[model samples]
Target: MIEHIIEIAFYLSTALTLFILMLPSQYGPTPRGSSDSAAEPKTTVQVLVLGDIGRSPRMQYHALSIARGGGQVDIIGYHESDVHPDISSHPRIQVVALPPHPFCLQTSNRVIFLLLGPVKVLFQVFSLWWILAYRTKPVKWLLVQNPPSIPTLAIASLVCFFRQTKLVIDWHNFGYTILALKLGDNHPLVKISRWYEKAFCKSATAHLCVTNVMASVLKKDFKLESPILPLHDRPANHFQPIQDDQERKEFLLSLSETAPVRGLLKEGKAEVIVSSTSWSPDEDFSLLIDALCRYSEISNTSKPRLPHILAIITGKGPQREMYVERISSLQNNGKLRNVTIRTAWLSTVNYARLLASASLGVSLHTSSSGVDLPMKVVDMFGSGLPVVGWSRFKAWPELVTDGVNGRGFGSSGELVEELIDLFGNPAKLEKLRIGARESSSYRWDDEWTPVAGKLLGLV
Candidate 1:
């Protein structure tokens, strides 16, 4: 399989090279990102993502930071959702949307992914190679996200190797670790996937990861000789606490007419909790559901009972419909009370606003690699909202810091217990909120410059 993949990539790259050489710049792939030709940034950077541009906020932030450093950025990815205006309207950044995936767009079935993965990679490899080779203006450096690294890593490495473009791979999580979640870690396919990651990762000129543990793993496990820097995810400028009472009320009223929103806007609301998920395999929403169920049971008879809670979940994914059905079942059978769970996908602006106004945030991500941290938790901290999340993973402590900005729980009962303790006591909740606000003071712009910007020679 590896041999065949290499053969295909080799031939396709050879064809692309010959075609590009035969055609002149005007006749070949058209010129782009040169609209303001007079005074363009001296350095051009390419940010690559093999998935939706809107969903991949970190890469978008990377582009924004590069632009602030006076570098032209060309973001290459799929145009599935509404990207933030900062990226779309930026004068120095240009988004190059790729053709949609041939298959595997809707389903999350592992069998279907296995059967059609290669074909999908073929399509992507062709399109991505064409873009990197000739479509956009020549870039001094290229940065790509891992996890969807099968074809992307190889393609970016080959392009950088030939074109002398510096390659920087930002590792959010391991691709093989995610594949291992679907297929057992010992599966032969999983073994091969790990090998693929280790092999192509060596091609990177520099590496940036989400956690220090991840950096250690890459150096010890992948035997990386390149510089590995851990750039922790921080919330952007848009996500901040709504300190003013009128601003908070106005934000709540601006939300669409939903049951959960209506419940929160009542004359005297107790509290509002927000949870965001991609509904992907990494997150165990069942844990959250079970926690809510336990809370409901305790709400009926337990002492120091909590107030009416509006738990709003925002984001879209495949498993959403199944969980929605389960929530409906609980509501119909007279099980759910004192709590309302609603799911909606909000635009970029609305999402930041919602995060800013919420009383608390929850993260249920069970990292497949156990070393990568959840960005949603970071976003919540940025919004000055406290969080409670699963605590089994090694990475959780680095972000959660029990009794500080947020708490961590190991089970549904523990989560419910945390909820009661915090919500029942306003003083404790306020303390954590204060901690989260302090956390928010450490903004992304301040964080990005010292690490990623310096690496790109932009700082």
Candidate 2:
């Protein structure tokens, strides 16, 4: 019954996604009422920001920031629902929708790509050709993400060939190396993806890597001199170091009353929140969920029974049902007696508020996970929550310290042990909590704004 339900959900999701893509894209917002006669000729600093920017809030923020930061920026991507923000509010911002195609998505399972097989390959090729033939002429500077969109970058490279444009492929996830490891070299898709990565690296004039590890990997593995600009997303307003006790208490109290947070503040029950934008097979969430279930069971029966731990995950993904089922199964088996798992779509504001209420934040990715730096970590620190993350990819260790800001465990077993420790000693958790708050300001946007200014020649 579970398997049948999952199959139905999967195909429904795929069909819906395909339907959405096939729909004709009515043009989105542009600079209000600026007539062609009144409009000045676009200066040479024109940039086209492309990819799945709608998936997360930061992506939209970053795209809009670049657009509004005085460059003639044109954004092309998905805007699924009615919750679209006024991204092109600035005089320079222009948004164009990339009519739907499967290759534009970052998939959770590589094996699923095999299910589409020849149709997938042909579709990608056709998408690439269509994008190249149609939108290739106008864009002078191309910014894109990896994996499914690597082919788009390949097409962008071809666009660069025609126009003397600078191709800026943002290394958000290490696509080629990750896919190669997951699907093996023998797979036709993997080979094409690796070739696309190699070609893009070789062809792109500038590469924007989101982390030092990604930059290092590109240089070492691919032998490309892609000078990386760490693409960090941070809050626009920088709060002064959270020093005063009253201020901290007030802030915590404020976040405690949010819709999703109300359940955590029962009379005597202690509560902690774990959140994510992406939860699927590729991510190491099972380890954390398992640990939480085990901890909840043992603690619920203790002398000073531990509080309920709620894992509130929000994001639409292929393996969401699997995650839901796993957590539900744990609950049914009585291991998650004091634990609750809820998965729903959340707006950016609600999501941020939820993160702020977390006593400790948790994030994970598997060794084969493609995303280089989970964007949620940026929100975690930005919200002043201590993070407890698994060291799956190369970047988590650099972002977190073992005993200081947060804890980084090497494997699933180690992650379980670390969660136990975090839950065991409240005093230690408080200290780490302080460290987490202190470390919130170290994200890429804070460090890269000046560089971004220089890139746009604002200076």
lDDT top scorer:
1
Assess every candidate by TM-score. 0.91, 0.78
Q: Name the regions of candidate 2 deviating beyond 4 angstroms.
A: 1-51, 56-58, 81-88, 102-112, 115-118, 124-137, 185-188, 230-264, 367-371, 442-445
lDDT for each residue of candidate 2 in 273-311, tens digit (9 for 90 to 100): 666746544575677776776677577667666666656
Query: Against the unseen true structure, what C-alpha lDDT does each candidate score?
Result: 0.84, 0.61
lDDT of 1 by residue, 1-459 (tens): 999999999999999888557432442222244667766575778999988999999999999999889888999999999887999899989999988865444457788877877777788888888887767665688999997988889988877766667889999999999988888999998999899999999989899999999999999999999999999999999888888867876777667634454644666455678999999888989988888888878877867657767778998887999999999999888777877788888888788888888778999898999999999999999888899988798877778778989999888888889988888888999899989999998888787899999988886
- Minimum summed lDDT over a 10-residue window in model 2 is located at 23-32
Steric overlap count per candidate: 0, 3
Residue 299 C-alpha lDDT in model 1: 77
- Scored against the true structure, residue 27 in model 1 reaches a CA lDDT of 27
User: What's the CA error at residue 248 for candidate 1, in Å?
Assistant: 1.9
The runs of at least 3 residues in candidate 1 whose Cα sits more than 4 Å from the true structure, single-residue gaps closed, are 1-38, 103-105, 257-265
Q: What is the lDDT of candidate 1?
A: 0.84
Report residue 339 deviation for candidate 2 (angstroms).
Answer: 1.1
